[model samples]
Target chain A: MTVGNTTTQRSADATATGAAVEIDQVAVRFRTKKKDVTALRDVSVRIEPGEFVAIVGASGCGKSTLLKLVSGLLRPSSGQVRLHGEDVRGPRRDIGYVFQRAALLDWRTARRNILLQAEMRGMPRAQARQRVDELIAMTGLTGFEDAYPNELSGGMQQRVALCRALLHRPPVLLMDEPFGALDALTREQMNVELRRIWRETGTTVLLVTHSIAEAVYLANRVIVMTPRPGTVAEVIDVDLPVERDYGQTMSAPEFARATGRIRDLLGATTTAE
Target chain B: MAAQSTIEQPERTAPAGATASATRRPGGAGAGLLRFARNTWRPAAVLAAILVVWWLVTAADLVKPYLVPSPGTTLDVVLAQPGYFAHHTWITTYETVLGFAIAIVVGVLSAVVMVYSPTVEKSLYPLLLFAQVIPKIAIAPLFIVWLGFGLSPKVVVAVLMAFFPIVISTVTGMKSIDPEMLQLSATMGAGPAQTFRKIRFPAALPHLFAGLKVAATMAVTGAVVGEFVGANEGLGYVILQANGNLDTPTLFAGLIIMSLLGVLLFVVVELLEYLVLPWQASRRTDATTTTL
Candidate 1:
């Protein structure tokens, strides 16, 4: 199965520029007793240095699978996944991931949770402490640094997750619906906070989400996907002004147009399949 | 749209007022402490009342002294022959403590190994199950026979009794991590060792402690059982001696002392839990308030 040429070329370009992540015609399939389920069909994507890109799709569209490919958590059945021009055979240290759930260690305080990443990365304790302080401040979790995951609100816990993810300053951040578990209000607030944090840190981010509005609000470009055995259906550029305020920018005509195009693509894909 | 507007408007207004109030009460220290006390006092009161009832029931002669000796008589026996019980009590305490330490070390190590290797888990887990199913008392005499009636047998019994719970709890705790957490750690370029130490171990601690608490109590019982089977010293041995002489009051005293020792050990474990996991307490508070 020849994966798309565009994805391969993009990956080649990414390799040249030392792009954070490059997925070149990557295909992933799972074998069960009864059947082989192809999760991604020659899907290819490239994330540039310091770009915020969102992958949006319906359920079973292999959005998470795409993320796993990029994170090197899963190998492509055929084709290549590259990071900094090197084929990513396993998890790369230069990428940070956040999940749908906060997934903080219950026994650890927020500060400890953030430090855990540093400890694993073998970052010196003294350096970790300074970084942790900066992260706590950036996340607006100064007072709750010593609070446990169970003690914080869903939004707060996610903030801790973000801090932990960013602690090591990995060049690429892979977020799989990191705010999906929060309530609508909390999710919106998290989106704003996330955008602000991303701008300040200047880390390239690949966010997977089901919400079109969210994809539009946070990403420079939104890659829409089809149903199971997923392939990229469309890649829409978001032309809205950067440095957004949630209240002022969310209602802009450009924002609505981008969301509309994504929604239309999703609707078409769902009906076609 | 109206609902969204209403929600947004309240949130904006509320944050300003809330921040002002929060700053004014910086850290919420006094109020937080008061709430903490308020929540804890009820449980404390109930426990005190239970103790009082036991005292009153024993004093009222509601049951025969042989069956349920008066608290006063039990106390007198304890005070009168402090040395008599103290020496034996120390023996049991030593055995219990030693066995418990061995169990913790072995349990944690085995759990870590099991998590890392499926082969080890497959082979050793069945053996653990087999060991746990056997009645500890039934093996106490065998331990005495094998170890030759010294402190070794008692300690062996205690270790055997305490080991299973810690292993099971630790294993369960280690395996119970959320997939997302692992993914997050992996994406952050953390290696296997880093993932486990930072994520799995800390996440599993509460469960591990739960098992440890149960094992602590079991360790004491194992020591006592060991003394009962064959031992020159310990509260259990004293009970056997008092039984032979028909000194019901003294036997009751020994039982009371044993109970006290168990309670004290359990309290020490609880204290350690609190010290190790201070964040848990605040989390519990947050849960209560949010639910309300």
Candidate 2:
């Protein structure tokens, strides 16, 4: 725990936790009025402990559906999603989920919103208070504890949302396009912040993003997914250095190559669609 | 053309910081008063103009005084017999408040039930609709027959009149929660009760208040309607009594008092809304201004 000090060194004192994910040939078919639409087909990917993985694809390519499956919000039509070698039968308290929208309760202030995790999990009040303070500082939301979600900016609201998600120090953090709604500049800033937090907390992150560049910029490995009946198209390693800068990372050759490859995969899918 | 260009340019200029500044600008009590005055003045001026026109028509003897009393005559009646109206107003207010309370509790609980259980909703939705379709005024006399012409029938009528809007708005509010938020709550491992308290109920408040404001005014109408059917006291009774005696001024005085009661109740609801949902109201203003 040192807050806002961007470093690659892991917190040895940080709670020993990282949820490894194994997607075993999972396929999801949603039965709607019109048809039994297959969202994912044979999507098998094993994420290592403490790894930051980004899944990127065109809209409707089951990127979010895959995240849902892992988070136990949805069960696959076939196969299984396992966390830390344990089957995900239902929503696991050990995993944190961040939605696309900040989804902050409009009535709750930033501090109250962050404390929601403690309230839900019934964490000891004093300890949860200490954790919330640290998280608020880490997320750069120190002065905005009393500010309502509507009072905060889009980026600030998302920061509160992130704080709420991480307050419980969950082993796995699943994000579904968390910064997709933000503008380009804010989104980039959030990316840097997210990377710093990930580095500090050492929590395993499974991020679903539509932006190819974003996927490369944050994740250790980018899982490119195909359109419609989405499965892993390619698992491209982001071969950039671990110590990354938002402005400098984009210009790195490896970054360019990784993003470029993901872009082509996405482009191919759109044409096929 | 200039306005359109200005609007287009703000998209480039309106950063997240703009909203913070916008809220901070309205800082002091003076600014608040100014804002209130700015909003209120136009309607106040229109009302004044209408009164002036009304006074002129009456001064010119355009209508028979017996048929429609002059504003001055009505005001005089209100002033001269303050005790007469006060007693009736008190009775009506009590009935309205009690009925409104009943409507709110029943309506909200029903809304929660409907939202949580589809089977209950499927079973009761048609019956709820049927209740709404029946003219409450037509059944007011029936309530009087069943419950007698005391506060009971009046309260029942008020509840009938006020229930629908509260139920409808609450249902909409409860259901209006972003699906993603619910999913996030689920993934947070919140039990159903915790999720409802933390997310669903708070989200529903703005919509509930909208319904409450409507129901508050309707409650007064319901109370008065019940009195109109059968009552010994209340503004409704006064109006009916005045009409029987052809005392037009007293009738107009009763009308004014009833309207005042409705306005007063509506204002109270609005104040409660401001207290409960400062975030919601402020957000709307910020959203509109940021577009500019």
Candidate 3:
């Protein structure tokens, strides 16, 4: 509680003002000719700017649906999603999205791939290049600006994606299991890099993952979701220092408490959706 | 120490993938020869066996002299009349090349149109299928009758023969783009044009070149079919004349020359693929070979 950082200070400030993202009683359903599938229902979350929120759920939980709502990639059957207090009507241009796969353009170099966000937004060339340099440096992708996605490692590709997402410096970032595809050690290393990047950039992030420990370690608050016709089962506040060391944070009581509570919540609902 | 390790730790991931790929990659000169032989020896031996049988069938006079002709006789026929054969080959090559260029433009444009408009796809898909499924030989006479015995009929036949492969391959390529990429690009504020240009178009190149290579061979056959029906000048005309006059050596020479044209165009498309898609060719080439 005594540890102070700009990330923590800005997080506190964001709560007093407008929320960065507000998912109000959102429900999403997909209908086919033969059947109707309810993806999510009665889901609500309020994410403060500069806050890290992780939604932990098993496959088919619609934790990913929650992110789609915020990004305006999907619409809820009911309720509403708002970004920066504005209702999301269509695909919102003011946000960045990272997927499990880095989704880097195979033909493009890492720098050019990152610049895609800028080019799409019509950002000034010199300004976009300058911002790209900053992100490349921040992500430790300095020397590999010219490498294609195929030439890069899984972790490096994800870093390029992270840089691309943060290029516009949007107020909110949405990640769908951004580190899920990496190996265990690489995933941990990415988790640490992501935390540092999040602190440095101070962008509000909504991350969806299946890993309980990942949610507890990287997020200020964890939203545990139930499977199929998913809804928020519980919200866990990880009462740990804003600046977390991998070894220290993993061993912290708060981390264990948060993870334990989430495991129990997910475990009980295993038999039914 | 933590900060120093952070920089170094991420780089460790790089070497793991690099080394794994290195093991799969074609090896040094000595190892490469072994792998090359493994992948290619069967095809080489099969071709050699066919050539020997062809020579024996002629040498033993199992067939009439004018019916099969010796391989040496066919070679002499080509060597004796280089200018005459060259003129006919040039005509066919020109017609096929022109038709192939047109096919690429039309094929790609139509594919783009079809992908963007479901209505266009629905309307044109059946016609495209029919074009591909129909025997070009059966329809060659129709094109010749409609356009007459000249460059126009031969070129038209070549276009019809070649364009379907390009269309199908190009459509598959454009549609094969990861849907997630489209969503991500949409979130980035890319409009349809921007998405197609940056995400869809470049992603489709490797497939498009693949289509072009297939189309290259088809175009040559189409041109020859056109000549088979009606032509004043071309390798097909040479072959037709030889067949009528029972000049088996000329007939064999014409067939070889036409096949060489197809191979030449195929090689050209391959070279273009390498130049245009430097990123894909290395990985793409490796996946095609069965080294074991």
Candidate 4:
């Protein structure tokens, strides 16, 4: 990926491409009219290029808040967030965000909705159209491009949302519980599809989800988190084979051990909190 | 509208009311026509039943003829004075249409401003509520006194009556957009103006059309009410003149024509909505027929 904003002096990392995302001692505190709430504290992660990282936590663990920090949608109370060695001062056009809800514009057809990113960024029309077609084929949304959001099933709607997010070919993709609303079966299918898509695109991904199975199934490493002043409790690495088949990956002992470790860590964190 | 705003779901923005009240797509040309027929049969049957009841009440002399004219007598009176009735109908129609047009422009503009600025909304919303509660008919004569017996007074009344629903619905639509969408827009580097144009305005349309349908009927009520206060012409004037003459048939005819005007305007607005918002779920229909 051609990193924009070349002005930021490149960080020294000879073995790998400089970190795609760097969160340095991050913290977020929401001050409402009443009490003050520390949503996250001392949270830091350095994500390398093309890495898939999942953050699994309880609802109040501020995992979604972490994703927002990376996307420049939320500013940390103290520490810094950087993308491609440049500080994230505002919403970065170089990143993509997928919300828990599909959030598709109902007035636009699926193709047009995907093309919304292009419209906002003022990308060249022909280039954008070709990219849209490629994404449609990639996402298996080929036959449903002209369909409206309400006509599509929930899974299909989220697929359309995924297509929209990937249209610009952002170097880093941030997903905040994207499949949280889908049924178990569809969620499984989407997880398989997402893994394949990530493999094909090689985009760095930061996914925040509440589903433990989903977290272990899709990420290189899962960051288990604790609530009540949200903090990272543990990071469990999955050592399954690269070509992870859905059934095979689930049956792998490494998957079992990693998932078990995560569950125990979460159980301890809940009581400790 | 306030109560509905608290219960805001994406579904809340769906064009709501009548099967005809609104929502999604249906199939091809022939099928759409067929669906239209199927939908209208119930309302047609209701109209037929009402006509039958009216005839029964008149023929049985349940009330004095001067008080409640026979449906036949009312129809005859209309048929008798095609020119006179048509002239009055045209005047009222023009007034209602003009008022509705002005209300839509003003209401939408104000709604945009109010949605963008909390200060404007804060200052104006209570005044809007107070104006609505005061009753247009009560102050309609004041419009006549200020604006005179010309069409402007009646048009002004129609505008006043139709304005609130449009403003309320537009505001709701503007606010109903998912916060995630705005975040998405920001990520794409869309400025505030582009966001409003490409997102907020289009999002507001379905609700705006709903408000338009409501306002369409209200505008007619307003015009007639304004005419009631002071006018030398229009259907409201015709009704008053017929009542004084004790010509119950003429009075009944005027009432029928007046309501027809309202329904006609409503249907026009509905048809416009259907054309403009084919994307709305209310209008969606799948193709069940065999296609080549």
**For every candidate, how close is chain A to the native chain A in TM-score?**
0.94, 0.92, 0.93, 0.93
lDDT against the true structure, per candidate, is: 0.80, 0.83, 0.83, 0.84
Candidate 2: residue B126 lDDT (0-100): 94
Clashes of 2: 0
lDDT of 2 by residue, B1-292 (tens): 0011111111121243324422433222344344445666787799899889988888899999888778999899989978988999999999999999999999999999999999999998899999999998899989989999789999999999999999999999999999988888887778899889889998899999999999999999999999999999999999999999999999988998899899889878876765556666566666767898
- lDDT by residue (tens digit), candidate 4, A1-273: 323221222342322338888877788999999999999997767777888889998788899889888888889999888899888988999988899999999888788999999999999999999999999778766556666676677777888899999999999999999998988887888899899999999999999988888998899878888875887777777777778999988888998998889888888887875
Q: After superposition, how far is residue A16 of candidate 4 from its true place, in Å?
A: 10
Interface RMSD (Å), each candidate? 9.4, 9.3, 6.7, 12.4
How do the residues A24-119 of candidate 3 rate in per-residue lDDT, one tens digit apiece? 777899999999999998777777778898899779889888888898989889987789888898999888999998888987778899999999
> What is the Cα root-mean-square deviation between model 1 and the actual structure?
6.1
Candidate 1 wrongly placed segments (more than 4 Å): A1-19, A124-137, A243-248, B1-68, B285-292
| Model 2 ranges off by over 4 Å | A1-19, A268-273, B1-45, B287-292
What's the i-RMS for candidate 2 in angstroms?
A: 9.3
Error of 2 at B74 (Å): 2.1
Could you give candidate 1's per-residue lDDT for residues B177-285 as a string of tens digits?
8887777677666778877877789778888989998999999999999999999998889999999988888998888778778777876776676556655544555
**CAPRI tier for the interface of model 4:** acceptable
State the displacement of the C-alpha of residue A84, model 2, in Å, after optimal TM-score superposition.
1.4
Residue pairs with clashing backbones, model 1: A93-B189
Against the true two-chain complex, what DockQ does each candidate achieve? 0.34, 0.31, 0.36, 0.36
